[model samples]
Target: MTEIKRPTWAISNPLMQQYYDTQWGIELHDERALFEMLCLETYQAGLSWQTVLNKRSAFEDAFHHYEIEQVAQMTETQIAPQLKNEKIIRNRLKLNATVNNARTIVKLHVAGRTFDDYIWQFVDYQPQRLVIQKDENLPAQTRLSVQVSKQMKKDGFKFVGPVTIYSYLLAVGVVNARLD
Candidate 1:
């Protein structure tokens, strides 16, 4: 039998390539998975996707596998140790933001809405497909992202700036950028 080469997007680093191949643009509908991706995307602010990808497992472990209820209840003391953990990004602000965002996720869940429902509503539950021959042409933010960011911020989510939201949208398949 012969081996086959796989096509992949050329990112700035190897971790980014792994993330793109394993996770990016994949359709995911589960609430827990959606929350996990959103938290990762939030942490990704002001950093490269490769950085987050490299630390993904550490993040999963440190954050209790992204269990919204547990993460929402985590105290500052509980998060303090993560700042010194070399496995994940050591930014204190990003760590706090993840905690705050988890609280928001819990609140929304209490309100009888999943993050998936709220976010997908922005696009009418359809993934916006884009035609791109190169990665450079991919946008960092869009009008829809801006709107979603504004809404999320108003809803008490931290680190959900338009750029991060746009990345989140793309990652969770809300905006699919497949060359067809």
Candidate 2:
């Protein structure tokens, strides 16, 4: 048997490893994927990323694959069932907030602004590469996350607290670790 070289966080978890190898920290440019990550980060509040990763499929199915338009169109009736869904995080507020956040993204698109457009401007349309020698030493939140979270809040995005946004930033490669 051989131990796979992986990020500290991805150790011993096939799903996390797959996410790390295939998705985590990868520079994502698509609006839909970005939106999906943002929503998942919120659901991750007070929970481990591994827990959320495990439920990613359920989240996708419950939220209509996180399509901004489709999710935005969801209502109490649509979201009510998901609150009782065993496969997904069962927090009603968080679930409703997901729909609300989707609606916010839809509003942005209606205003000729894409979620990617609003988020990327924070870094001048460039990824902020980080030189972290130890992932354990990374701050729970950063100045950039604080600033971005505030702006997203003003723009009516829910569940975008600083720490959550920081995680989102890292997951989407808005904040990337220096490979060298």
Model 2, span 1-180: residue lDDT tens: 544345577765778878877787788889999999998999999999889988999999999898889999998998888878999999987998898998998898899998888888999989999876644467889999999999999989888999999999999999986344
Q: Which runs in model 2 stand beyond 4 Å of their true positions?
A: 1-5
Overlapping backbone residue pairs in candidate 2 total: 0
State residue 152's C-alpha deviation in candidate 1, in Å. Answer: 0.3
Decoy 1 TM-score against native: 0.89
* TM-score, every prediction: 0.89, 0.94
Clashing pairs in 2: none
Candidate 1: pairs in clash: none
Quantify how close model 1 is to the true structure by its C-alpha RMSD in Å: 2.8
* Global Cα RMSD, each model: 2.8, 2.5
Residues 1-180 of candidate 1: C-alpha lDDT, one tens digit per residue: 543222344355676666666677777688889999998988788876777777889999999999889999999899999999999998888899888988998898899998889889998988888656653467889999999999999999888999999989988989987444
